[model samples]
Target: MIDEQKQQDSMNNEPNQDQQTESSESLEKETAAATPQETEVVAEQDSVPEVETQSVSEDDNSQQQSTDTTSTEELQAEIQNLKQKLEQEAQQRETVTAQAKRLAADFENFRRRSEAQKEEIKQNEKRETLTKILEIVDNFERARSQIKPETEGEKNIHKSYQGLYKQLVESLKSLGVSKMRPEGEPFDPYYHEAMMREPSNEYPEGTVIEELRAGYMIGDSVLRHAMVKVAAAPESSGEEENGESEKNNSEEELA
Candidate 1:
C-alpha cells in the first residue's frame, strides 16, 4: 500500500513538471518574436540620418533654384530700364534737331533783312550825292549862257566851259542820269509842263515848239519835268489881226 501511493504521487508530479516546462517554452517563443520586432524598429531608427541628409539636399537644390529665378528676374528688370533710358535719349535728340533747324532759319532771315537794309542805305547816299552835283552843273550852264561875247577872255571861257561840260556829261552818263529835250516833239503831259502856247506855221498843232528847261531821268525814274511851249494851229489873217488888237489893248491897260 505504501509503494502504490508513492507511485501515484510521482506520476502526478511528473505531469505538473511537464506542464510547467511547456508553459516556459511558449513564453520564451513569444519573448523572442517581440525582440526581433524591437530590433527592426532600432534598425529603422539608425537609417534616419541618411533620410534626413537626402531631404536636406533636396531643400538646398530648391533654394538654389529659387535664387536663380530671382537673379533672372533682376536681369530682366535691368534690361527694361535700359530700354526706357534709350527711348528717352532718342526723344531728346529729335527735339534738339527741330530746335536747331528753327534757329538756322531765323539766322537766315536776319541775314537777308540786314543785307536789304544795307543796300537801302547805300542807295540813299548815292541819290544825295547826285543831287548836289546837279546843282553845280546848273550854275555852270547859266554862267556860260550869260557870258559876253565881246570880252577879250570870252573865247578862253568858252573853251573851258566846253571842256567842263564834256567832263560833266561823261560823269552824269556813268551815274545813270540822262537829259531829255523835247523841243519839236509831240506833247507829253508826264514829262513836260507847258508854260506857253503859240501859233506856228512850221509845226502841227499841239507840237512841242520849245523847251524852257530840260528834263532829266536817273535810273529809269524822272528827276525833273521839262518846261515847254506847245504850238497851236495857225490863225486866219482876219483872226490874227483881231488877236493882235486885243493883245495891244491889254498891254496899254497894264502900262
Candidate 2:
C-alpha cells in the first residue's frame, strides 16, 4: 500500500507540472502581442502632439499679423481726423481776422465822417456869428462918418469913438477879416453888387466908378458884397441938340 500511494502521488504531480508549463507558455505569447500594439499607440500619440504644436504656432503668427493691421488702420483714421480739425481751425481763424479788419475799417470811416460833420457845423455857426457882428460894425462906421465934432468936449468924445473903431478894425484884421477896395477896379458880379449906374468920362464902361458900401473878405471868401456904382458910356449932348434943330426946321417948313 505504501508503494501504490507513492506511485499515485507521483502521477498527480507530473500532470500538474505539465499544466503549469502550458499556462506559462500561453501567457508569454499574449504578452508579446500586447507589447507591440502598445508601442504603436505610443508612437501615434507622440506624432499627434507635434502636429498640434505646429498648428498652434501658425495660429499665433496669424493673430499677431491681424493685430498689427488693425492698429495701423486706427492710426491712419486718427491722423485724418486731426487733419480735418486743423483745416476747420484755420478757416475759422481767417474768418475772424477778416471780420476784425472790416470792422476796423468801418470804424475808421465812421470816425472820419463824424469829424467832418462836426467841423462843418462849427464853421457854419462861426460864419453866422461873424455876419451878425459885421452889421454892428456897419452902424459904428456910419456914426463915425456922419458925426462932426466942433467943441472941445465933442472932439474928445469923437476921438475916443474913432479910437474904438480903429481897435475893432484891428481885431477883425487879426481874425482873418480884410477890407476890399472896389473903387477904380473892374466891376465883378461875384464880389460887387451894382447899386447904381453912372455915365463917367474918368472910368471906362463896365468899371466900378465909386464904392457906395465897403466890402469885406475873410480868407479868400467874400464875406460881404461891395455896393458899387458901375460906369456907363456917356450920352452925347451934341447928337441930342442936332436932333432938336432938325425937328424945328421941319416944323417951320410945315408952317
Candidate 3:
C-alpha cells in the first residue's frame, strides 16, 4: 500500500510543473505585441509636430508679403500727390509772370503816348509865339520904305537896313515861320478885332473896311487878332439934322 501511494504522488507533481511553464510562455508573447504598437504611436506624434511648425512658418511669410505690398502702395500715393502739387505751383507762377509782363507793356505804351502829347503841345506853343513876332518885323519894313535916300551915307544906311531885314526874314523862314495875310476874306471876330467903325460906300455893312494891324495864326491857333476898321451904313442928311435938333432941345421944350 505504501509503494502504490508514492507512484501516484510523483505522477501528479509532473503535470503541475508542465502547466506552469505553458502559462509563462503565453504571457511573454502578449507583452512582445503591445511593445511594437506603442512604438508606432510615438513615431506618428513626432511627425504631427513637424507639420504644425511648417504651417506656422508659411503664415508668417504670407503676412510679411502683405505688409510689403501695403507699404509700396502708400509710397506710390505720396509720390503722386507731390507731383500734383508741383504742377499747380508751376501753373500759378506762369500766370503771375504773364500778368507782370502785360502790365509792363501797358505802362510803356502810356509813357510813349504822354511824351508824344507833350512834344505836340510844345510845338504848338512855339508856332503861336513866332506868329506875333512877324507883325513887329512888318512895321520895320514900312518905316524903312518911307525914309528918303538923299546922300551916299543915307543910301548906305538904307541898304544896310534892307539887307538886315532880308536876312531876318530868311532866318525866320528857315525856322518854319511864314506870313499869312488873307485879302478879300469875310471878317471873323475870332481873328479880327474892330478898332473903328466907318460909313463906306464901297463896302457893305459888316464888312472889313481896313486892317490896321495884320492878324497872325500858327497851326489853327490865333496868336494876335487883327486890329481892323469895320464898314457901316451911311447916315442920311435928314437923320443928322434930327440928331442935331435932339441934342439942342430939352424935354420941357418938346412938350
Candidate 4:
C-alpha cells in the first residue's frame, strides 16, 4: 500500500510539470509579438513630430517676406506724398511774390503823382499872389507920371517916392520879375496887344512904333502884355488930295 501511494504521487507531480512548461512557452510567444507592435508605434510618433516642425518653419519664412514687402511699399508712398506737397508750396510762394511786386510798383506811381499835384497847386497860388502885387506896382507908376513937384517940399516928397520906387524895382528884380521893352521891336500877338494903328515912315509895316503900357515878365513867361501901336503902310500924297476934293464936292452940293 505504501508503494502504490508513492506511485500515484509521482504521476500527479509529472502532469503538473508538463502543464507549467506549456503555459510558459505560450506566454513567451505573445511577449515577442507585442514587442514589434510597440516599436512601430514609437517610430510613427517620431515621424509626425518631424513633419510638423518643417511646416512651422516654412510658415515663419513666408510671413517675414510679406512684412518686408509691405514696409517697402509704405516708404515709397510716403516719399511721393512729401514731393507733391513741396511742389504746391513752391507755386504758392511764386504767386505771393508777384503780387507783392505789383503792389509796390503801384504804390510808387501813386506817390509820384501826389507829389506832382502838390507842386502844381503851390505854383498856382504863388502866381495869383504875384499878379495882385503887380497891380500895386502899376498904380505907383501912374502916380509918378501924373504928379510933378514945383515947390521944395513937394520936390523932397517926389524924391522920397522915387527912392521907394527904386527899392521896389530892385526887390522885384531879386524875385525874378523883369520889365519888357517892346518898342522898336516887331509886333507879336503873344507879348503885345495892339491898341492903335499908326502910319509911320520911320518904322516898317507890322512893327511896334511905340509902347503905351509897359509889359512884365516872370522867368520866361509873359506876366502882362504891352499895349503897343503898330506901324502901317502910309497913304500916298495923291490919295490924300483926292479925299480933299471929294469932301469939297459934297459941301458944294449941300449948299
Candidate 5:
C-alpha cells in the first residue's frame, strides 16, 4: 500500500511543475514584443525634432526676404525725393538769374538816359551864358561904329577898338552863334518882342514891319528875342465917302 501511494504522489507533482513552466514562458514572450514597440516610438520622436528645426529655418528665410524687399523700396523712395528736390532748386536758381539780368538791363538804360539829360542841360546853360556875353560885345560894336577919329592919337585909339570888336564877333561866330533877321516876316512872340505898332498900308496886320535890335540864335533855340515893330490893320476910306454921298442925295429929295 505504501508503494502505490508514492507513485500517485509523484504523478501529481509532475503536472504542477509543467503548468508553472508554461506561465513563465508566456511572460517572457510578452516582454520581448513590448520592448521592440517602445524602441520604434523613441526613433519616431527623434525624427520629429529634425522636422521642427527645418520649419523654423523656412520661416526665418521668408522673414529675411520680406525685410530685404522693404529696404529696397525705402531706398527707391528716398532717391525719388532727392531728385524732386534737386529739380526745385534748379528751377529757383534759373528764376533768380533771369531777374538779376533784367535788373541789370534796366539799370543800364536808366544810367544812359540820365547821362544824356545832364549833357543836354549843360549845353543849354552854356548857350544861354554865351548869348548874354554877346549882347555886351554888340554894344561895343555900336560904340565903335559911331566914332570917327580926327587926330593921330584918336585914330590910334579907334584902331585898337575896331580890332577888339572884330575879334569878339569872330569868336562868337565860331561857337555856332548866328544873327536873326525878322524884318518883313510874320510877327512871332517867341522870337520877337513887339516894341511898337504902326498903321501902314504896305504891310498886313500882325506882320513884322521892321527889326529894331538884332537877335541871336544857337541851333534851334532862340538865344535872345528880337526887338521889332508890328503892322496895324488899314481901314477902308471908300465906305466913309459913300456914306456922305447918300446923305447929300437924301436932303435934295426932301427939298
Candidate 6:
C-alpha cells in the first residue's frame, strides 16, 4: 500500500513539471520578438541627427551663392552706367562738329557774295568813265569834219589836229573801244536803229543800206546804236509801179 501511494504522487508531480516548462518557453519567444523592434527604433533615432546636419550645410551654401549674385549684379550695373556716359559724350561731340561745319559753310557763302558785289560795283564805275570819254571823242570828230584848210598855215594846223585825233582813237581802241560800220551788212536791231526804209535793187531786203551815224561797242556789249537805212523789197515791174500810181490816185479821189 505505501508503494502504490508513492506512484500516484509521482504522476501528479510530473504533470506540474511539464506545465512549468511550457510557460517558460512562451516567455522566451516573447523576449526574442521584442529585441529586433528595439534595435530598429535605435537605428532610426541615430540617422535623424545626420539628416539635420546635412540640411544646415545646404543652407550655408545657398547664403554664399546669394552674396556672390549680389556682387555680380552691382558690377553689371556699374558697366551699364559707364556705357551710357560714353554714348552721351559721343552724341555731344557729333553735335558740336555739325555746328562747326554749318558755320564754316555760311562764312564761305558770305565771302562769295561780297566778292560778287564788289566786282559788280567796279564794272559799273568803268562803264560810266568810258561813256564820258566816248562823248569827248565824238566832239573831236565833229570839230575835225567841220574844219577846212584854206591857207598853208591852216593846212598845217589841220594836219596836226588830225594826228592828235588819230592818236586818241588808237588809245581808246587799245582800251577795248571799237567802232561799228553797219553799211552793206545784215541789219541788227540791237546794234542798228533804222532811220528810213528805201526800196532798192542794189541790196537785199532787210540789209543795212547806209549808216547815217556811227555806232560803238566794248567787248560783246553795244555802247551806241548806228542810225541806219534798211533796204525794202524792190517793185516787181513797171506794171506794179503803174498799179501803185493808180491806187494812189483812187485814194486821192476818195480824200
Displacement of residue 17 (Cα, Å) in model 5 is 27
Where's the lowest-lDDT run of ten residues in candidate 5?
A: 246-255
Return whichever of 1 and 5 wins on lDDT: 5
Score every model by TM-score: 0.56, 0.66, 0.55, 0.61, 0.61, 0.61
Across 118-154, the per-residue lDDT of candidate 4 in tens digits comes to: 9879767766777787787887899899999899999
Clashing residue pairs in candidate 1 (N, C-alpha, C atoms within 3 angstroms): none
Checking candidate 5 for backbone clashes, the offending pairs are none
lDDT of each: 0.83, 0.85, 0.75, 0.83, 0.83, 0.83
lDDT of 1 by residue, 1-255 (tens): 999999999999999999999999999999897998889888999899889999999999999999999999999999999999999999999999999999999999999999999987987787778777877777877877887567768788788887998799899988898988798889988888888777778999989888777777788776667778888777677765786674443211100
Candidate number achieving the greatest TM-score relative to the actual structure: 2
Candidate 5: tens digits of C-alpha lDDT, residues 1-255: 999999999999999999999988998988897888888998889889999999999999999999999999999999999999999999999999999999999999999999999998999888878977887887886787788789999999988988988888788888878889898999999998888776567999889888777888877878888888888665467634787664443211100
Give the Cα RMSD of candidate 4: 9.0
| Model 6 RMSD vs true structure | 12.6
lDDT of 5 at 42: 89
- Candidate 3: stretches off by over 4 Å: 1-80, 117-136, 145-152, 193-207, 219-223, 230-255
- Which run of 10 residues does model 6 get worst, by summed lDDT? 246-255
Residue-by-residue lDDT tens digits, candidate 6, 89-193: 999999999999999999999999999999879877877887788777778788888987799999999888888888888987987879997989998889988
Clash number for candidate 5: 0
Supply candidate 5's per-residue lDDT for 190.
92
Instruction: Give lDDT: candidate 2, residue 138.
Output: 89
Q: How far is candidate 1 from the true structure (C-alpha RMSD, Å)?
A: 10.2
Q: What TM-score does structure 1 among the candidates reach?
A: 0.56
Q: How far does residue 139 in candidate 2 sit from its true spot (Å)?
A: 1.5
